[model samples]
Target chain A: MGDHDAPFDEPIDDPLAESLRRSLEPDPTLVPSAERVAAVRRAAERRAAEHDRNQNGPDSLRNAVSSRSLRPLIAAAALIVVGMFAALGLDRGPDGDVEYDGDIAGPGGDGTLRVVEIGIGRLVDLDTSDLAILPTGEYYELWFVGPDDTPDAPNRISAGTFHPDADGRSQVSFTAAVNPELLPTVEITAEPGDGDPRPSGVVVMSATIDR
Target chain B: MGGSSSRAARLDPTTLRQVVERARHHDPDAWESLYRHCYPALYAYAGRRLSPAVADDAVSDALARAIERIDRFEWRGAGFDAWMYGILRNVVKERYRHVTTQALPTDPAQLAQGLVEGEDASTALLARTEAAQIRRAFAALSESDQDLLELRVIAGLSAVETGQLLGKEAGAVRMAQARALDRLRAALRGGLDG
Candidate 1:
């Protein structure tokens, strides 16, 4: 029998292996947000468009212009098309500034927070001071809960995790792929270091912000 | 090999080829399927190795690069995920260079993306304690051991697939995995006992 067929007597659910599994496997429900998916789609579209132009545009134009022998016009046209696609590949989000701010309410009413929807993704900035101390072995996680009408109905995207200082204060800045408009509710939940990917259902603080 | 065939059975051969073909042609459905298929595994691997912020950027950049270079990617024995992983390694390497040179992050707020936000505080605390113990043992392993674990567990690649990426035979990969697990178990025991 090949090595692959050599069955080990050892159980697959050995404690060490289970621990490794728990530590490594992310939350199964975790997925790319709609905005992230849209960004990728847009990027792929631009690349596909560029690829098509590279394949057909120059060749067809070359054939046509070759019949008339209009070499300079073909060169100029190719350059213009290349330039246009390059510009298309650039940031497609709004040119204007888009920002949202609100205060998170907890035992001590944690400080102000900001969510800036820039091109492609959202920038989440959180600041807290003199908040209630969390129990040992727990940290705070930032979540972006989408609006009720979202297709997922009730979905929350984890921004990331953080732990406050000795004084029960923390400042965090991170980017998330969620749409700022879709995510009006920002929640902070105390989470364990366990491998579970979903929020712990413990809402330490929460706020509704307008964009 | 039986293991190889079993894992390969999950991906229908026809659908695999079709996904690649349609994605090359810029079919939205195909692209979405491909993206969704690879994103979770890629995110897990990158998130463990780097901060969530860098991990997200690396995944996005890797997918964009794959889309741009899809035409050039030939269907080798491995699937599309393997090819994408190769690109992702390069991107992660670039970021790793930057991270290693910079001073470690001092912000107490900086934490990895993965956390258990379950309802029971006591359960969560026990889980965290166990997780921390496991992490310490894992860190005690050799770099090669860590890499193998990362590829198998974090990347969620089957033994045969991991073998293909590492250019080793399936038999050798299985042996390595067994030995690595054994070492990890010993390390964990030592941590608990000592």
Candidate 2:
């Protein structure tokens, strides 16, 4: 009850969602051109490298030395944790939870896409709708082809990573402990295909999964 | 089935890693592959966050950082995208602070609770009317309110990290978030209802 009242209890959306529909309709005028987008990307990569060098200076190379040494400690702890968890009666949950994500494009808004994975639990949901039994450690990440932002600049929202059902297809399912209504659209990067519950290295596939 | 084969033609994470590893070792072919693969999205993220001029700088900086850093890349479960994002987040956050001329979002929830979810039906409806309208309205918000709303609700940054990035005292981010949210409610309701 800050300055405004809570709408959650109201449970009333725009009468017919006419406004929501109109709001979603894309505007051709605002769309980023391909040429402009490509130029920005080329420039950004050049700049990222330059900035890193300037900030880190020559000492940057040596800095990784420490990070590398600490890696083992992290890995060791992870391993011990894994071992202990395994030894305990700790039981893993059902293996059927599938995750998915995609992008949501609204004209003239942030022009930024969001994390829209639907099948996994990190930043998204475990769509129990379809129980096809997907594995852990392997999931998807989203990426776009042109400039990341609509108006200008380039940026990639992780769009989240999730476990895909073995069958790899299902109904619309999304549960977000975060913001649910404004969930981003999703695409499958196919970064991982295992049951390990993590994103694989490469983006294999992506689709603009819309609502 | 042919679609699957065609898709396989595109690099997956393992293949992308191999490409990066080759590039790290000075393999021109691998370098070319790496550039071809990551250039699009990385470039896109930068362009949107910064001006074209600064974007060029940021992108090149990230790449160079990767070159020097590529060796150190452990290729843990986290892929280059995750690693790159970690670096890019800093770049965007730095620019956000500079351009907006504001201190850290003392109250982070103001962004998420307010900007994204307005309690007033009329206000939420208005914000959802047009992305631009919302953006312009968003721009008018006070410095703290803007930051909190952008990172938490709009940009969807984590509350704890939003606090760290905004530079409020420890635990202040949370309390601030509550207050910030209140501010947002006021702004949206005030802006829209009126």
For this target, which candidate reaches the highest DockQ against the unseen true structure?
1
* Tens-place lDDT digits, model 1, residues A94-205: 3324466667765323578877666657888889742333334556788888766343354778888887664335888988888756767888876655777676665657
Assess the local accuracy of residue A48 in candidate 2 as a C-alpha lDDT between 0 and 100: 53
Give the lowest summed-lDDT range of ten residues in model 2 chain A.
Answer: A1-10
Candidate 1 CAPRI category: incorrect
Task: Tell me the tens digit of each residue's lDDT in model 1 across B1-194.
Answer: 00111111222456767787988887766776776666666776666566776777778878887787787666543456666665565566544535532223323233322554666655766666667667667767875576667666555455655554443445655677778889998998998899
Clashing pairs in 1: A199-B117, A200-B117, A200-B118
Model 1 lDDT, residue B175, Cα: 79
DockQ scores of the candidates: 0.11, 0.03
Q: Is the docking of candidate 2 incorrect, acceptable, medium or high quality?
A: incorrect
